[model samples]
Target: MTETLDTTVAFRATMGRLASGVSVITTRTGSTPIGMTASAVSALSLDPLQLIVCVGNHLFTRTAIAEHGRFAVNILGEDGEDLARTFAAPVPDRFAGVAVDDSHGVPVLQDAIATVVCQVSQALPGGDHTIFVGDARHFTHKSASRPLVYFAGEFGVMS
Candidate 1:
């Protein structure tokens, strides 16, 4: 009999080696702000200014995105590990005590390396996650700082 490999473990380990930029994907339901740490973001296109973020079905942000139809992608800087952890945690207010500013009426991390405000162009099912494709409406970036990176299931800076 052949021993079966644990595909889940193997897949995670393999994907963990793929370094990705860390970001906070935020969306709102009315006055309530919801966000989470995510590294599954991609620039899908430039001509149409398209971007994509994968959100797990279990996250509240997933429902917010579907209801509000808009989101902000805040690209974390090297010093944003604390913020990343805060967002990733099951906190009551992820934005509590966190400075934020509005972009196209959506809340974005204050002084983030980059922020993109987008409208939900489409949402597709990606296995257990939902792929939210956004049409970039507005964006801003400042400061020449290194980005926060996720690799090997840990946060690191590209140095």
Candidate 2:
């Protein structure tokens, strides 16, 4: 048990050194929007425009995404630390006072550096997380904004 715990700690510490862009994955169940801060998003293919997002199995957003069959990845800007914390926390209303647009059938963060709307193509079990493979349908971005980054247990901007 001690060895397993030590390995888990070491693994987390090691991965924390790898800088990654932060994003908020958003989806809606009927009229209610659900979102969560995630750093495990990546492009999987370009031929058919596919990306992958990993959501923890325990998160409500994971089930929402699976049920909704669509989601948006809001790549946050350098000024998005507060927004990141809001979505990452267990707040009752994460969207309180936050600007959002759901015209595309999924919630999109209006202030995000980039927003990608995707239709879920596949879902694969990935250990403690669900790997959602999305087929990009629409996207928009702000050319002038720098992305929010996560590294070593902190939020930062690329220099």
Candidate 3:
């Protein structure tokens, strides 16, 4: 008899082939800052200018963003690949070597291609992750630079 293939592996392989921009989702509560490398993000609205990020339920940054009611999406540039990998790993103090600036209250990556500050408009449960819908508050206009892209389990610079 033939063995059944794992759907989970299939899903991952298929998605891995899809090229996507890299971004860091960040927030702070009190004096503590939180960040994570995320590729599961996209715009959800235009009238109010909003976006959604899928964060694991147990992620510390997810809880912090909920508590703080705010977050900033730092779009990584070609040079930000290292930063993206750092944030993706479970290393302590992901922001250890990262430089940031406080815009309003959100911590924005100084070297990011762009920074979009947003307020949490809704938090919806989606299986193992929470989908946070954020309404854009402030942002930096896109600058001249290539973005970091992830594809097939690897990182690359956009042409």
29-61: candidate 3 lDDT, tens digit per residue: 799888999999898889989999999998888
- The residue-by-residue lDDT of candidate 2 on 28-85, one tens digit each, is 9889999999999999999999999999999999999999999999999999999999
Residue range with the least summed lDDT across 10 consecutive positions in model 3:
1-10
State which candidate, 2 or 3, has the greater TM-score: 2
Candidate 2 least-lDDT 10 residues: 1-10
> In candidate 1, what residue range of length 10 has the lowest lDDT sum?
1-10
After superposition, candidate 3 runs with Cα above 4 Å error = 1-5
Ranking of models by TM-score: 2, 1, 3
Best by TM-score: 2
Could you list the CA RMSD of all candidates, in the order they appear? 2.7, 1.4, 3.0
Better of 2 and 3 by lDDT: 2
Per-residue lDDT value at 68 in model 1: 95
**Per-prediction TM-score, please?**
0.94, 0.97, 0.93
**Clash count for each candidate, listed in order shown:** 0, 0, 0
After superposition, candidate 1 runs with Cα above 4 Å error: 1-5
Error of 1 at 87 (Å): 0.3
